[model samples]
Target: MWVEVLGWIIVIVLFAVGMAGTIYPILPGAVAIYAAFFVYGFMISFSPFGWVFWTLQTLIVALLFIADHAVNAWGVKRFGGSKASIVGSTIGLIIGPFVIPAFGLIIGPFAGAVLGELYARSSLEQSLKVGFGSLVGLFTSVVAKIVLQLLMIVLFIIWLLV
Candidate 1:
């Protein structure tokens, strides 16, 4: 029916946006994708994908959410960043989007980590290293999210076809 076609179109759009969000950090990327799936499943009465698929997707989203933070912290620590640097990076992530928009998200964490290291009385060279580490961590996390998102999409498509 026309309604079903409309639903598919809306879901696809949302999925695309969600995938982009994973890269940009502007939107809840994985969450948005999951929401689309949830809506689709609901519309179809969960007949095919059913509760098991929903549960699997939910777990994937939760794991990715936790991993994002863990990976970032790990990156900072791996680079010998102090506790202050970690705190600074967190603050940068929160404020970057608002301060500089798209690019700010990328720059904010590095700047924040550097500033934090400086505040902790580290040498300038060491602070820069910490900042670089923070940047690396952010990049790693984004890549991980993208891979996971792709897997989710693939699963959705396979389920749809079957």
Candidate 2:
């Protein structure tokens, strides 16, 4: 009984962190959620997580990786950004939190896109437009990830119960 209680606590906390990770790139949110599932099933009984379920989970992880990059790249391209802009945005994303914790995530991509476009000899106005696109893409990704993570958690709960 005590072991089960402790497991629940760990799983809950990890899930919460995973949800937060969807918005904050600093955390491995999706993986954390997947870990929670693994921990729960392992500590209790792997009977619940069959091979089919594990396969789907693995595919979801892959999808997350593909989506993250695709959305960002699409955003840059749709807004007339070049490869340099994408690279810059990626760099900014990695560096943002470290440089400015409060708003680095928001500012990093925008600034990076702008700088990247400028480097490519784009006009200031064009650079700014690309920055806005980056911002849109960032927010869209965050929302999409949040929904996906929630759905994953709900699915796990269903699997556990049923």
Candidates' C-alpha lDDT? 0.86, 0.85
lDDT of 2 by residue, 1-162 (tens): 887888888889889999989778989988998999878976676787787777877777777877787888788889999999998888888789789999999899999999999999999999999998888878877887887788778878887888
Give candidate 1's TM-score: 0.92
Q: lDDT tens digits, residues 1-162, model 1?
A: 776787788789889988888767768799888888867766554666877777888889998999888888888899999999999998897788889986788788999999999999999999999999998999999899999988888888888888
RMSD of 1: 1.5
Where is model 1 poorest over a 10-residue stretch in terms of lDDT?
A: 39-48
Runs of candidate 1 exceeding 4 Å displacement? none
- The all-Cα superposition gives candidate 2 an RMSD in Å to the true structure of 1.1
| lDDT of the structure predicted as candidate 1 | 0.86
Provide the clash count, candidate 1. Answer: 0
